[model samples]
Target: MSIKKSPESWAPNADQDLGPVLILEPEEGKNFWQPQPANGHISVRISPDFLDVQTPFSLGTQTLPAGGYVREHSHPEHDEVLHFIRGTGKAVVDGEEHAIVPGKTIFVGRNRRHMFVNSSQDELHWVWFIQPNGLEHFFEEIGREMVVGGEDPTPFPRPENVLEIEARTAFAPQPADQRKPD
Candidate 1:
């Protein structure tokens, strides 16, 4: 998280490629999270430069392009606050798919298995807030925190996992999905 800059750094390409060039390989060292895509799930950390703040709770944006899917997964340590800024999608929690659209917000509690898919024609953009602070940093600290073979629990249904069943819930339903979540 280095913010050093030169006096002329912002002067319209005056020092192109001079300030910082970052390359993070999660396998190479600390302060990085290792990520792997499996089955229908794909996710990537928004790069250090893209991060607005590097401490406490981490804020980042992710995309689930049309036809893309995030396999069932859960956060054991932190609850997540997700706000969909664009497009449409469906989130599956407790074995149910709930429709999602622009302006929709969904809160998935810690350790709850959940998955999301873009079922619409456009790409889905959502900002994620990881609570209890520094979710990304913690992931980096533990080497690889989220992935197909990682220790984090998958949101998908697994006979051996024994995920606690909770009353499924949602923020609000899109006009298309008539049934409301309680």
Candidate 2:
């Protein structure tokens, strides 16, 4: 049996009508994946620009090769959530380390230093969401778009305007002491 709701409950508002549904296939996203310089990792931004929503969050997927690690950093203005989909890794949040695997979820509060390191032989796959939006623009500005099925170009140096971008985004770099032993 179906139940009826009040007109206000079912009605679409202006805010809802302003956003359109977006469906991005994996193949379509692969073309936008950008590899991190000097790191065996790639990321595909999935939201913000994709849907152009007015929401406060952005989404993206990242694949980290075995032994790859993201340098520790923190967002002074936004919180981050990461959900692991494959492989194993270690997440250091505020200098505390936790082993992570498929189905594991992590919540990092704003201004907490965090980084991820792939420890398994295979790739680590995860989707990350950042609150208050805008981080995707930083990634786009710093990362080079990867060509599908083609060799990656030589890693480009960090953008000269990184500090400017960081100031605009409230992204703060942190010194990392978590590294896989040789």
TM-score of 2: 0.75
TM-score for all models, in order of appearance: 0.48, 0.75
Whole-model lDDT per candidate: 0.52, 0.69
- Provide the global lDDT of candidate 2 against the true structure: 0.69
| Residue range 1-182, candidate 1, lDDT tens digits | 33444557565787455534334344322222222221122233443434344344555556555665655666656688888888887888766777988898989887776777777778777777766544444333323334435554333332221222211221111223332222
| Tens digits of lDDT, candidate 2, 1-182 | 11223344455763344334556666555333444432444454555555556666787787777776776778988989999999997888877889988999999889888888887898888888888877777766667777668675534466777778766764875445534322
lDDT leader:
2
Query: Whose TM-score is greatest here?
Result: 2
RMSD of each: 10.6, 6.2
Instruction: Evaluate model 1: give its TM-score.
Output: 0.48
- Candidate 1 segments whose C-alpha is farther than 4 A from its true place: 1-55, 133-182
